[model samples]
Target: MDPLFEFLLRQGDNTLVLGHRISEWCGKAPVLEEDIALANTALDLIGQTQMWLGYAAEVEGAGRTADDLAFLRDAWDFRNLLLLERPNGDFGHTMMRQFLFDAYQIQNLKALEASSDPRIAEIAVKSGKEATYHLDRSRDTVIALGDGTSESNARMQSALDALWPYAGEMFLADEIDQAMAADHIAPLPLEYRAPWEAAVLPALAAAALKVPQDDFAHQGGKTGRRHSEHLGHMLATMQVLQRSYPGATW
Candidate 1:
């Protein structure tokens, strides 16, 4: 229950889950160019996961490696925000989901790059650059789709409405976050929320997307207490190769 362990795990879990979701589009994207783009973004996320989870393994001082932590954990043990685990409903939904997460993650990483913990800070710097690219891609897609044809606009708006509630979970401050902030290991989740809003709201407005007024945020992933059923299904697929051929590597 170390604060750093939990903090690092949560960071890894978010990228891992979302990356897997994005990877689902490898061959299914709307166009050939988009397919390649989505795949590349997924790779970026998976790479980020390795850095974060690899560090978490070291911090835990346990025998578990990053692969063990990622491929062996049960559903309830994951600490990702719920937004990342939701099924990708459509192209619009996928972009909206990425936009929401990228907003918070980019800000979080920027602050993390200055961490009192040098290891975390180094990882943050590397990952933060990747996040900046992700934000640009997602933001551009959100704006273009939201301001496009009536049908595209409607779909983008719907995606925003469905995904907005989950966004609040990214900013929820629990003891682990408070402790990390107190030690200068990381910023409090709330620290990024306002800037996240500032970046997102203007994008949403430009896209003609309305921000949902609902305050209900589905949480509990950080404490490893709750997860959508989708995560279990994702784990089943993601861990299969590792589980079937334990320790097999190139």
Candidate 2:
């Protein structure tokens, strides 16, 4: 597989999966304002996915559109991070996951703004704007909830402990990362990890959430070798419309 296509899949799939997960909160959010915000964020992520996956399709030259790549592929074909695929256990858990991913994206997208590939740079720039808002919203929510009453604090802490292991995979530099870095198309995991940690650690501390000590990370999402059962379930719902309709449109 072309490294660029693979790289685009990682970017697109992350947003696609995470966007779908976030969308689960659309009508179900705790507050009306929050429901709107969550829906808007989901739209932002799916918009980003369109850009990334559309580029990927062009690169692959396989006559597949972005919608096809997104809705038609099975679980094994996705290359998103494992953390994003985890079920939205609760409001706290969802916010914690969003905060973690937003922090990671903010750092990397800023770096990607300088990518040698103009297409990548353009996508990064546009996505970076939305990402900035996402980080702010998720970070504030994490801090507020984590530092809130006993129940909220405990839930946030639990979410952190559960999701921390998955965070490590975002910084695991594989051969594809190395290749992108070598060509100046993208930075290696290490290149952005420092800033990601810098952004994340202080937030965790402020939230009174204890950062887990474990460095172990579950992998395979980015490689699509294996994904948690949650992803297949998500795809079943997200793809059902397109799959059943077979390119049906207005």
TM-score of 1: 0.97
Listed in order, each prediction's TM-score against the native is: 0.97, 0.98
Deviation from native of the Cα of residue 115 in model 1, angstroms: 0.4
**Candidate 2 similarity to native, TM-score:** 0.98
Off by over 4 Å in 1: none
Best by TM-score: 2
Distance (Å) between predicted and true CA of 10, model 2? 0.4
Q: Which ten residues in a row have the lowest lDDT in candidate 1?
A: 219-228
Candidate 2, residue 6: Cα displacement in angstroms equals 0.4
- Candidate 2 structure lDDT: 0.94
Worst 10 residues of 2 by lDDT: 187-196
Error of 1 at 144 (Å): 0.4
Assess each prediction's global lDDT (C-alpha) against the native: 0.92, 0.94
> lDDT at 39 for candidate 2?
97
Query: Across residues 120-232, which tens digit of lDDT does each residue of candidate 1 receive?
Result: 99999999988998999999999999999999999998998898889888888999988998999988888898899899999999999888888899888777788889889
Q: List the residue pairs that clash in candidate 1.
A: none
